[model samples]
Target: MSITWYIHRLRAMGPAEIAHRFVEKGKKLAARGRMEGWSRYRTSGPLPVLPGLADNLASAPDRVKQDIVAAGRDVLSGRYSALGADWPLRDPSKPFPPTIWRLDPVTGGLWPGSEAYCFDISYRHERTLGDIKYVWEYNRLQFLQPLAADAALTGNPDAIEAIEAAIDSWYEVNPPFRGICWNSGIELGLRAISLLIVTSLCGSRLSDATVEKIRTILHAHQVWMARYPSRFSSANNHLVAEVAGEFLISLAMPELPLSGRLQAKGRRILTEEANKQILADGVGAEQSPTYGAFTAEFLLLCCFAARAAGQPLAKGIKERLALFSTFIAWLSDAKGRTPGICDDDEGRVITLSRHEPAYAASVSAAIAGYLGTPAKGPRPPEIELRDALLQAPAGGPAPPTGLRTFAEGGYTAVRETRNGRDLHIVVDHAPLGYLSIAAHGHADALSVIVTVDGKPLFVDPGTYLYHSGGEWRDWFRSTRAHNTLTLAGVDQSTMSGAFNWSHKAVASLDGIEDGENWRLVASHDGYRNRFGCLHRRTVASTLHGFSIHDALTGNPDQTTEIVFQLSPACEVEINGQEIRIRSEKRWLATLSFSHPGQIESAAGGPAGTGGWYSPRFGIKLPAPRIVWKGALPPEGLLTNVHLVPE
Candidate 1:
């Protein structure tokens, strides 16, 4: 866990040897991409991606040639990967030597990377090599190993040479032929890699030695899978990979003892997890359009793998999977880019598409192949998958209801649909899967963002960057970043420590009903232990605007203060009546709250947004305080807040 442990391990590890291995592997891949460009889709231009059609298969060889030729041009033009034979080890200017596993705060520490760092690498940054080893299994190592095995299966000496070189290189950065960080990575990676090997070799009647090696690897992966059931227990990508991998290996190798039972359990997990992960409305909880697509693709891949192996995947899994992918289509703009809500806006790359086709292409293709129909109906053209995959969101004919759950994105969006007006309120009730709420999660447990008249009066600052130093990440995770009530001037929960992914509390939608308007009551335990606190936030549409209240309750006598965070540009009006603060270009807001008779008011001090990296710009009520008249009521503390018209 200590830097010294890593350093000592590094001393025993050979950086030069590791560097040589990785460099050689990179060279082989770069060479392959140059030799067979179709494998990496290097030649596809940045628009109208039409390369993966069945018609193209007739001229597959020629296409591959053209691809390689195009890639060769990039190489000759000096526009490809620049690693060559010397990389991290020989690059003395880099922070850590190639073999020595060290964590960059921008990345993570060596041995046991933070859970936040680990989950991001696995689910978000899976394609990239990083301190988080959990990703290696499901993302990189699993997919890469098959290419190496395919070369060996073909009896292609060139590919075998490349495979050997690649494996050697992989081991240098990843010593002991396993991951360096979490044990979960090793368990997951080995399963994926072995499954890849099994599928790659199963298509060919290979030599005895090759077949035996494949079986051994497959068995080893099963052993790892049995030991790591927790990996599949969650509703994330790792669970998907586990189920699919188990099913694939089991069907491919029927004689294995655990294969049948694992397949059964895997199928169950897949079905249940799919339901849980795909929201009632069909969007990933990460609130990321790209992650939504990525998650759907993983589900579809698993579904297909299960079906192909004769495993009876549940009937609704495919439909549910397609629905989630379709949600991605719904959110994408004309250009195919889903709004960058979370992590990477680019989405995850599955194949060599020219542009990231809004990730709708992958789903479209899967639906086309599975449903035996082409995409059509009411969805966007970019995401309109073949007919079979097109299923409308729940409550089809009826317009969607308010406060619908977006399980995939881990938030609840409650909208007010009255007459022709559209008002929206999104609360982060997302599950703690791979995403680290540490920075993205606001301490405002029952914090809410309201968009009245479709304008953001209150908001969560989204995210800045995970690597821009601790202060930046901390501020992004602080209570000040969100629209919520902070008590006693304490900025939500204390944020001085390192980011903790495990420190999660779900904000569940307990009751939602239709009155003359809409009412929402949601709660979370984020503040329970510290203050025996439970924040119950209620929003109801009123005559003009909406009425907001937060009932914070605990024990004993304590003085609690609540602030309704507004955009610095907002023109503030306090109470049911409008009383303006004096300012124009400067920030203005009315501050008032009835806390019994004890409620007091003060002048504006320096209540501006702090945090050096992330600038919370705008006018702040320097020293604003509203007096509470008397003792708090049993209904808890009620603060009526509303936004003023621009």
Candidate 2:
């Protein structure tokens, strides 16, 4: 870690956090000695299997069971896949790769596993881990779910043997409190969930010796999470995942001595953290729709586990879950595609489907099932299977319809049907981010995303890279990268570090007028302190189309540039002052500006400076970006977009 990082941490974190880390480091040092002979340690007794495990397994839809079994057989046959790649495990009879292993997917650099934590390994800088994402994928043990499924379905002895051998190999290679895999509580939490799923499904087939080893490893994970929970500003989604993992382990495996304590602690933390990280508007505190979906899924899993254990969720928790589901459902476009705003790591708590980059429809369907409501759209097979597993009662109330505004979240959605076509538009004028770090927040203040007939026309460029600490990271998060106005070529929010924002732009909704046409007005003071200017945006949505007026107050001499990023699928042609946007040779909309300005189209080039879109983490594609630059007029500027559906 650099001195700058430490300074930022000190400034962002409080004295209590510093003290907590001090103590946590000591505990880790002491635990290192105890972890040496962890494999030889004997459990006090046989672990207690979860109550109603068999019933819950049996409750899964027959189709889901068959799919799980099929996935497991595929894994055994060395045809498994993860992170958009084919990943095959070696034969069980062969020794596993050494535990002290570090390979950079991006740069293909390998290092001893022991050095994973000892040295300051910048996964981004060294290009050693490519994204450090694959490491987490490998450690999450999600691949094991299929194995457990196969073992339970066919009573396949080879499947059971494979699961046992894999678990043992991981344990032997990765000692507790060591290596990159042990560095994250979120990873540990995911592993715990995977372990529980496997054990709950195939525990009957495992030998006593194998069960003991699994229990021992689980205990270590529980202790680690309990000792070093993601606290303070760090307590975001990672905290939720960690506590949920501990809670699930405690609920599913009553065999450990600390299971009761873990259960209570986990429950308390999960409940409190859910309320803390999830806003009252049902949006995640992180302010990213993708992260919000991921968090909601995690909470849903907790609710599922709680229900199975005969523990009902708190009334407030259930309501919050419903709100979360509603928010995502409403934000999703007609095609069930959500805007890739803020930091999207493409993280999932579980893989129930083969759909790449979990679809909004599938997530909404699963949520609808859990909440006992009719799905708003067509349900995919994965969602159907999950709905069955969730045991949702058929036929219930539907979610509220029409234009809704989450004032606290600073999100407004206007949905209308014209000419038998659905038009949905979302306006964001929320705070820059959640906590001090705002780790996942983007600098796209006053940005808007619009979908006509369920297709994205105007879009958010999306986060392309984090932790790479390069121009690309900065460019992706800069003001110019978003569909917003930039003053003097400055970002709306100051980027202090890779994940930290300083001098944040404070934005608020000025007012909203609803009628046959809806109007939303909002402004941000990000430039007020620096350039003595404030950017005010007005969006009016009519049946025919929409108009966006941007005005800057205070500074008239400064340069102003307005950007409108188009979806990668959109093809645009500029004729005089009118810009026509089309997709697949079909005209979607036309944009016109009131004042003459320099217009330019941008795409990624060899210089690495241009327009680009990242559909998922670590993947970028060329996209069209329209820029309008001119002197900041005393009266500001206006741009009108008319949707001309044909």
Candidate 3:
């Protein structure tokens, strides 16, 4: 971030925030001066392992051991993949997993470190830094868990040797607070979790020298997290992750005198944040379902650590966990995939398996297993493995499964099983996320996602990029990228930056009724300020499919383009006002428009243009998009989606 941009962002903050920034700046300078000295690279010390971590690792089922062994071997063999994209993390010609820690494989940008201040790094600028996320993802060292677990399970010499090399290389290169890894609290938090898990899994086998280095690394991580905490607008998931990291470490290392202080602080902050970040109805306040799951995962991991230590969090968390799990069950499809409502970076506290496209189902199952909530279906194998590691009960209550309304979360759904088809539709009338910045929230209000027989048809394209000054970032979060009506060729909410919202659109639930056909009525004022028009959508579920009516009530003569973003599985055939979608050779659905308008179909853009969908972070695939350009009539622009019976 430039000084000019810093000043501009500061101008947006309030007096209290500005004051806090100055105080933190001074504190950072003092800490920077101390950490920059010769003591930073120190690597000689004795660190005690966390309580219960060793036992839990030992008790992992044989099933988990088998998968982990393979993954560990793959990681050692230099087949590194992250965030649903394969990474060229190592120089294959050199020895295994070389010092490529600072390399951003995406753009091939190498970050430098010679006593650099954390705030001085220009990591957010993609043109220069090459997507800091790619760098940070690898550096999180999440891949090490399986490697160490492999060593623990099979006493694999190669696994232990590879683990030692990775740790030693990390210690040699990225000394505490001297590199980009030490900058963000969330990065520090996630990295701390990975380190703790590895230590638990293979602390006994690690070389004494490597163990000493880890001891030094963990102490530095604790100090950094304790000193600098994310606050105000940035305090959403980042705060929870940081505190949870501190809490888990503290729970493990109770021998240290300061460990209790960190433990109490982490526990308190996490408890408070669980309530603040999650709505009463279980939806994450960020308006992103994935973020909700991320927070839930963070909490669950902490709870696991606490349980291992025979200390549990306060009662407030259980209530929220139940609600969060319920929300997941409702949103999840037949295949266990949930709606990609807003921004999702595919962030996970633990990277046990990368094959699952997203972690909501995994999280849902894990939560159910831990809480003894009745699971809806057979637990996923990965979920079973995680439960075994966390020591959750094997079987419990069958989780509730049905469509209902979440009034507080501003959502309603319709589930139908008729005509030999299973259809589910979710109507989003939710806020533009939480906090002043509304970070991670998309400009997609009154958007509807449709799934038939557990397959996405009308989809909400997942977020592909963040902190990039490219058009793709805007496109992924734009109104045009959703299944909704886009008016005036602009987003529903204005963007200040990648994560910041300059102007927000307020959405409300007009009404919801069910008789012969299930209907949802919602409206948003995103364009009312500029165009003096409100976009109200009526979504009715029919036996065949769905009917969407986009009404510009305040002004009927306004022009708008109705967009229905298709899943990557869809192939389109457009003819007149009726458009057909096929999944390979099987006809899926047909969309018929009532308004006389120009029809255009788009697929495969060079860089985040129309007709693209992101299933995971850092990955976008070509998908067809249906665009209808016409005037909003007084009765509203009607489009019906008729399901094609097999």
Candidate 4:
């Protein structure tokens, strides 16, 4: 690890987190029998349940019950799917073997199995086997939902028995404060929420002993989260998830002695963090659309849980939730695909729907259902699940439609109907990220993502991997990875570590013109510090097409490269200065540039530096990227995109 990473962690972590690490280290030492002094915190008394909790569970729509049961059956039959992998569940009745931890589902490579606890293993350092993301996927315990759901829905004693057996096996092998599963507070929070959901679904099917074990695990999770809350710059979506889990545990199980304190603390943290983490315009502070959606879902759960417990959220929080939904609605294309702006792990608060994580429409439907707003597009089954859980009504006043701008969030959307075809363009003119770390932000300051009649043309190459520590990680976050201009072959923001950006580029929206056509002008100072230059981009949309102009303020002689990354589905044919872009076997647009420059295409090669797109985590596909290289004259460079309808 670099000194920058250490300094980042030191600043981002709170005093409690520092203390918690010492305590956890001691416990790990004791577990290995290397230390004689260690202490374990214990919770007193039995777990509590709030009034009407059972009634709320019973009130789930009959359709939801059927879905849960069917999903559970799918899991039991060894057909559970996650992260684009279909893998069979090991027999739940047997103990979970240590070998399962070494298997990387994405690469089909397995590390040498180790009997030592996972916490002691440096999974990231074992680079020979490739990515270790799948290891965390396995530890997420996502399959627990289906098992608990099946146990509850069928009222089958064997199903409940198997569920308890799996829990027992996991507890036996993984102790508190140890293992990769315990490494992240967000993971622990997610597990606590999942356990609560299972408990809610299983109800009377669970044995007293099983319930006690579950409660014990929940108590441990609460303690861990309390000691190591994701705070400071590190507090992005992770903090929202952590506190939401704490809130769910406190709200769902109130009988425990610490429930009241936990409840109050959780609520307070959520309320304050929601306001802090969600920008005034409803964009998540992390600035990734996928993570923004994830954070919204987390908050929605808290909202629903609190309401169900007869403790409604404050009016401000409710309005903020609605704003979040509205922001997503505006950001989504006609097909409901959001621009993958930053890091996306395909993470979900809960898998209520079987739809792929990239399907932003499903998320919008759920949000619309919860807020009682008319959904902007087709509703998915996930929306029904949200309605069933919240008992919220179907329709309300429709949200405002048309072009919108969020100044604070530094995003502008241009939506119009040209030749009876819907056109949408999203422009980014935001900071590198939220705070000191900017952990999830990218270096694409003036990048643009465009869709015509619901088909993506110019797009953002989504984040493929993190912690890989190679060209792949750096390339995905680079300015060249986005639809923007790169000056002197340097990033708009300086990279301090994998997640930290120093000497950050600051972007500002100069002005917006909306009349016969929509126009936006923005500039960034990322190059000023190094090259004594400023990058200014002007985007204008007319009835038939759109144009982008790239200019430099300080140095007109600087050599710059302008890139437009095409969506994976797009096929490009270049003829002279005009490039034809096609998707789904039909021509989507024609691109023309004014400057006499060399155009090159990038597709992945042995070097792994080329045109590639990652629609989901751990999945990369070849894509066409049009790169224009030349010196910037005083007049600057201009590229015009003309939309074509089939």
Candidate 5:
């Protein structure tokens, strides 16, 4: 066979050396033991069905199988084929296509799409794979294989021939099988593998050459799986597939030379990757709640497959999946929406639910199967409390927490601290997964969103997407979008560049104590990205309402204007006696007053573009960047009252 030629050509490593690599890795895993709840014993072949396997749900028996069949036909027949359009690239042949990789229209810098597409897709898709791992592929294989086998068992020569021809056509054209350095090609190869398995099962005639080709492809896949040094050995969702694919294919073809020890290496790599990548907080390193759920689902599939194949189901594997399943469930709200902190696929990636309720049900099913816990009703606080249990070892400074409002990693959490009487502060800072903050970051770094009662007099204008229009992008990242001091003439960072390096309005709420009226002192570097320095302070008045104090330093002569505009969801009222603002969504009302300190301007600043800034979901807006500007007085303070229900 030509397999030796390919394997030796890539690296002259002998089979012994490759096998040794796996053995060494196994020893390292053994050293870690079960302290981290990782099991060293690995599995091969179809996973052993657990004790309650009969109770396991199979996504409603593929009730939409006909729809899937129709869709499959459409895809195969090139009907409704917007393949290139759906992707930013025109062709898969090109590396880093210009659509996602080009000079920014504004900054003259390299576009962010290249990094965005790779990171976002890999991270998010892997999350989906987490929950559905190989199930989609395997289930589809199971269906197609049996159907093909039946056709062959009967005298349906035409059906068998047609399936064989399709498999051959796919294999002939697939880029990886042909010599191409494409990631999508790897995915396409997976598709081809599924096709071949189905065709072979259907009593199709196969030449000796075809069987050899299958062996070559499987070997190629294994080589691809092990190419990346650290990757093949890690314990993340990616490793699960990378290793699981080879293990499954090898098991299917008993003639392959893969030894039990060799297969154990791949499984070891899977476990190791999972341990390091999944956080004790039950959050994936990638940090999107949607992806978190994705990861859990796929891993469950892996465990199921392992157990069914008679391999040992690693210790704590099910618990980890259950934990993350719960985390995603907890992050979801009544609306079944998470903070879009990252590129959430709306559940379409893994063919899961799109909205919250469906996702809640899916999670419940997974949890019930794995944890035997009830899947419905309000989530227990233990979900949040258990976050502490996921913390990395001692002396590793605790992962960011005590946040009042932080949305990153496709999940947003808003907190209202009542540690002190009538004191309130909100913080927002979460890890950024695959989402772009190029337009949504605010100038109010460490800026606190304050309220007196149930009114939101001062706030950060919740951003909606970048493509809504240019005005939306510009305005959403402008000083006006946040509750902070703005110089009348000076602008925040130019809205021409991606938001990765750009400043975001965030706060540190680790050491806040409730005393008088709620008081939070936070800082943001958004303005500093342009002007050398500028600082603003917002204080909730212990007496009447809330006031924002402006402290300006750089560009002293720079005309400054301080406008306290209410957020879109806020109800605003301005009067001589008091200003009241209220919001039902946030369930808080606030009054805001700002003093134009050492700053003066007659004409309000230029209007910035405004709108939502997500690629996955659709958003609508009325006008472009909205603005309100006025004169500023030296050392001034503006006050607003927030009314919160007593």
Candidate 6:
């Protein structure tokens, strides 16, 4: 996020995107659209009954019901802890619910207040404003869903009163088109979903004045989204979320005159974008599984919302949605935890279950119910509430119990039982990311991840920061941060900003086959520009562990650094050419290199480059990383990883 980085980013855009930016800039100058375009239009139709579907929550399990009610009671006490990814942004003080909408609760800084047009606000330039996501999360008002759910769960008039007051307060503080809260389209979409959830669940419990006020607010949001969309390179998950918001608004607030128009528009664009943004194999084009889950949930929930409105999507739409959850099912471990591949803001479309594993289960349940298939795996508590929320039929096939290849998406999962060990390995040969900027992708082409019997060993160091991170962002996103080969000490892809990758590495997956166990053959030309070589790797699975063969096909003289990032659960010790990686009781695997010249284990260094793991967003802890440095012979270099018994 520097001037130079901005220049490179602009230069990276295509002519069409450049033209769109100019058009958007002109709109900004004119102060047109985006919550300021026009007054509330005329009303029409019976106010949507779609939101009434939330009444079904009465059928949800008592455990989930009690948890939601308890969370709601906490909110009633002026504390909102039903937070997702952006938890650090909230103040731990009392009388918190009435806290200023524009306050950055973490830094205690007042964000550019109601006087500033959202267009002119420079969140990146103003460190005092804090991360924009933090403000957006607090302002999203999603925490109110449980309040509304509580009201519906029982005849709790207090929850209803709190929600009405909060809405009235939010509108008064952050007016239309003014302040940082109105800055992004995705924020509007997210808040829209939250609003509908509240209104639908609370139903007649909310005052008529409040219901009409929500209808007006939702209409303004759709007007902004329709006028100024996330177009061109920006059309990733943001677009999906925006359209989903509009679709829900149309379903929940049919009184808005534009409801019919937006419903049609939302469905068309969602269907089109679903095919465009999601691979045929069901992986999100963004290359980040966390973001993938976020996107899939948006589309999936929107699909359900449409159904609840008595408007089902095409058969193909549900088919593609099935694939989405299937990929998520495969990526997740035995504990329902899925490792982050690229960036993870911990973006949740809605937070019924605060726990990540439970969140995964709920999404899995929704997908299963929609398809009327058996669930991918055993689920934790709270699935009943999610099933109630989606109104989907419950079932999906279990996560694969054997090697599975997603050739089109460039991912291979080896999830199976071998030699009495439940081994799970996720290999990445995917290109940087989805489109031109490859926004969420890291320079981690041809990297590898391994979990033996559900314990992480070789892991992808999760995304620790975005936007505010400086050198830390670059370091965590580099080739050096992943379990892959680096030639001449350079990343596989070039990054200009936290979200922008300038030069991208083209990764090709040669094959995924079974011979001696399962093997994956892949290569990337990331270093070919500088070193004139293609980094080719062949990962062959073993009964015990891995037989990895690496080679430089185009050029052979460059020195290579093969890094293996270990899980924080692991303890590493090395002697000579071999390294032993272990957890609590015993070593999980023994690792060694072919013709190693120099090797070292890095942890808690002064530079802070290695030995770091981010369990969640905004948190990073020290973990060991093994770096192997040497030149391979003209022939090749081979690595052997043999499993150790407990």
lDDT winner = 3
3 against 5, candidate with superior lDDT: 3
Candidate 4: worst-modelled 10 consecutive residues by lDDT: 34-43
lDDT digits (tens) for residues 206-273 of candidate 2? 98777877787788888778778888878888888888888887776676666799888867776776
C-alpha root-mean-square deviation, candidate 6: 2.8
Clashing pairs in 4: 48-254, 48-255, 48-256, 119-179, 602-611
* Tens digits of per-residue lDDT for model 3, 335-423: 55778889998788776535555367677667775676676433333442355565544443322334577878888877776456777
Tens digit per residue, CA lDDT, model 6, 1-646? 3688779879779999999999988987787344552244324334444543575577666766787788677667654432233233334332334346776655667777677888888876466556666677777887787788789888798788778877877766666788887789999999988887787777678777777667667778877777688988899999998999888887777656667998898889888887877789988788887677677788887877777667877667777777777777778775567767888777777664243544555576677765667776644444434566764443444557777777777888878765566778888988789888888888998899988888998899888767656677787888988999988887888887778888999999987786446788999998787888898999997777777888897655777888889988789889899988888767688888778668888775543456787777666778899988888766677889887765
Candidate 1 segments whose C-alpha is farther than 4 A from its true place: 2-168, 171-183, 186-237, 248-265, 275-296, 308-311, 319-412, 416-422, 428-444, 451-457, 461-481, 489-511, 524-534, 553-646
Q: Per-residue lDDT for 329-398 in model 5, tens only?
A: 4444332333333323332112211123234324434444444455422332211100111111111111
Q: What is the alpha-carbon lDDT for the whole of candidate 2?
A: 0.72
Candidate 4 lDDT, 265-294, residue by residue in tens = 877877887787778888777888777777
TM-score of every prediction relative to native: 0.53, 0.91, 0.94, 0.89, 0.50, 0.93
Better of 2 and 5 by lDDT: 2
Clashes of each: 34, 4, 3, 5, 102, 8
RMSD of each candidate? 12.9, 3.0, 2.6, 3.7, 13.9, 2.8
Which candidate would rank higher by TM-score, 1 or 2? 2
Off by over 4 Å in 6: 32-52, 81-99, 353-361, 378-385, 391-398, 606-608
Candidate 1 C-alpha lDDT tens digits along 1-646: 3454333333332565445545644643443322221122112111111112212222234433334234323222212111011112222123223333333222333432222222222322222333232222122333333233333234444334333333334333432223333245234433443334423432243334333444554555565555444331133555555565665566556567776898778678878777765665676544444455555655665565555545557887777766664554443323333323433323232232112334543454444455544432123333221111222121111113354555435555555544344555666555433433232234555556654443444544434444222354555455544556555445545442322343555566666666556666776665676667776677666654466566766632444544343433344434433333323443222334444434333433322242111111111223222323344455765444433434
lDDT of each: 0.43, 0.72, 0.77, 0.72, 0.38, 0.75
Q: In angstroms, how far off is 15's CA in candidate 2?
A: 2.9
